[model samples]
Target: MKLFQDKVAIVTGGASGIGAAIVRDLADEGATVIIADFDEDGAIRLADELGRDRAAPFGVDVSDPQAVEATVAFAVAQFGGLHLAVNNAGIGAPATKLADIAIDDWHRVLGVDLHSVFYGLKYEIPAIIASGGGAIVNMASILGAVGWAGSAAYVTAKHALLGMTKTAALDYADQNIRINAVGPGFVTTPALEKTMTDDERSGLAALHALGRLARPEEVAALTSFLLSDRASFMTGTYYPVDGGYLAR
Candidate 1:
């Protein structure tokens, strides 16, 4: 049987980039996935491509507690139970220094990148417990461990996520629910492509020991493994898929 056969999963921000890759990986491994994202059309397109029965679309602002709760309920109501989830929704803050970042920008980054995951845990945990327990993976970043200039808000949120992952994992370990966080280095995605020039991208790539930006699929592979039985003993830890970026 496939790794995730008979499992049901929800992946926020699942319509594009790393989230979309994760959605594809889970569905391909036999999980019924809910592609939850702010982009309803993109979610729908992806769900359709995956086949309606294998994947469904959910339009949500993950930062909203109500929307996140509804997503978990929707997964259970539609798929019969919840088995896995990836809190992959996040946003990048502008390139501004700590003191220069607008108040709105700071809150906005935290709302989506940090609060969203908290909301996911609040709703997903109960459902997973009711459904007999499963695994969850939160998408963090290398900034969680290190700092980056002009990214104070993003960095703070990711740092908090690592702590949250550890605490939540410990809280549910005895219940058969595993929780973990993934920290990825610079990944080549549509957003990155649109935002950076080739020279800029090359400069960022040089920061990694691998000397290149990682592909979304590379991150997805680690996420998939974490959500599968293959990682049965893993929990309450942060796994870095950072291409040796932190080796520096």
Candidate 2:
């Protein structure tokens, strides 16, 4: 399980949901991990649970370039080098038609979900190259490859991320820095579950071709693999972890 021994990883939004699961997976696989999130308390708590020496917590706002730069610097300073990064920090947008969507809401979701990835790469790529190249897993969504009603902003951002990911992966493939994006379907995380009533949850479950939502750990498995050498040839592609949702 020590597949990542001697490597260090920085996971944004590592305080909860898929990010939290990624932190645990990387740490368990013997990678020194930095849990970077605006949720300082949650990060600190997880760090404690994982042992301070192996996992560190940082307060980072991914949308802020300066904050993101400092967080990457802190991770490199703490671990002596960087080998991987998971840009998993993002927010959800409301399910509203484009015509009825608030302009401000569009801006907020895009800033958090899309622009933040640019910020992450802006800072992390140079550091990874300086340290001699590494891997990056950007968190897109099933929406990245398709669109749905009332999800214009979120879908737009996710799709944009896929385009960006391909660009980055091609740009750095020769440099040994692989960049890939994960497009998850309906992963049942606390955030998704929290907003659903029992009936709503049932309907959402039935929407997936598998008749159920995915677990956070399941998504984490793909994330961990992408960060590992096992996925050395998998850059620039969007791996959908949906239960064949797009097929239907």
Candidate 3:
């Protein structure tokens, strides 16, 4: 599992859920990983648990370009250079129709879900380029490929993220940097639990052809692959780890 040995990686939103899972997978596979998240305590705890030598905590508001740049600098300062990045920090929009959604809510959701990714690439691309090239994975959603009612902002951000990933991949293809996006179906993370009742969760699960929700680790595995050399030929693509949610 030393696929990422000697590599340096950063995972935004690395404190919990799919982000945390990606951090653990990358660390376990011998990469020095930085847990970049606004949840400072959780990030620190995870880094400590993974052993301080192999992991470090970086608290950052990804929507802020300055904070994102600092996070990239921190990774380089701590691990020598950056080779991989998972722009996974994002938030859900209020479940409301576009006509009813608040203006502030729209801005907030887009800030975290879409703007943050741009900030990440703005800084990370240069750092990775300085390191002589690397890979990046943006966390998107099945909603990126399909419409989800009552989630205008979230759906819009994911769709736009997929477009960004493709465009960036084309821009960096000859520069040794590979970029891609991952779209996951309903995953039972702490965040999701806070938003849905048990019955609602069950109903959502039934929509997936697998008759169950995806696990955080499952999506983590796909993301790890995208960031590894094994996926060397894979770029500018959107992969769905959705338990067949999009099949229907």
Candidate 4:
């Protein structure tokens, strides 16, 4: 379904994992996509693979407000306008107790996962407004709704995103902008795979009521719907693309 035909979108962290999947899906549906990521090479590679006419690579360190603003400018310069965005860039923290987590680590995690979203919204909202109306999806996690041990920073940042999403939605609804959050259960992404043993991965899967991890495409699908006109009335909400992880 070409739900995004003739649209322009900027998806941060679009080089891989759930971000990459969303980029591909948007392009396939006829959206001109901006592949924004800290990994410039990967972003360029994906843009080339998807065809430059459908996608453009943009180097952005979302943690930097200036860099985030630059990405918005790049999208407008390249696409003529902006309409959709997914603030999906995030970082993981080590498995350490709250008391044991270093202050530096806490800052780093929230800087990427939380602050970056705020930066994206700060700039993208204006651009979307210029385009008349649009939607944004912030990448939260299952942790956004619940807490997990040894992940203080990650949990705190995600929880903060929920509030941010709701407030932003209210701020822009009259202006024809919709803002929302997506919470994904553990997906077998490259980063997650690198940290898990086979047994450890199996145990993690079993924690979900569905007894499996979510696929990046699965999460991307929800993001696509949220960003599409089909979800016109959906805003200030958190949609979980979890494999029933929260059910248990």
Weakest 10 consecutive residues, lDDT, candidate 3?
A: 89-98
- TM-score for each candidate, following the candidate numbering: 0.99, 0.97, 0.98, 0.98
Q: Which stretches of candidate 4 lie over 4 Å from their true place?
A: none
Candidate 1 global TM-score? 0.99
Could you tell which candidate, 2 or 4, scores higher by TM-score? 4
Clashing pairs in 1: none
Clashes of each: 0, 1, 0, 0
- Candidate rank order under lDDT: 1, 3, 4, 2
For model 1, how many clashes?
Answer: 0
* Model 4 Cα lDDT, one tens digit per residue, 145-188: 99999999999999999999999999999999999999999998
Cα lDDT computed for each candidate against the true fold: 0.96, 0.91, 0.95, 0.95
lDDT of residue 173 for candidate 2: 92
- Pairs that collide in candidate 4 are none
Alpha-carbon RMSD of each model: 0.6, 1.1, 0.8, 0.9
Q: Give the lowest summed-lDDT range of ten residues in model 1.
A: 93-102
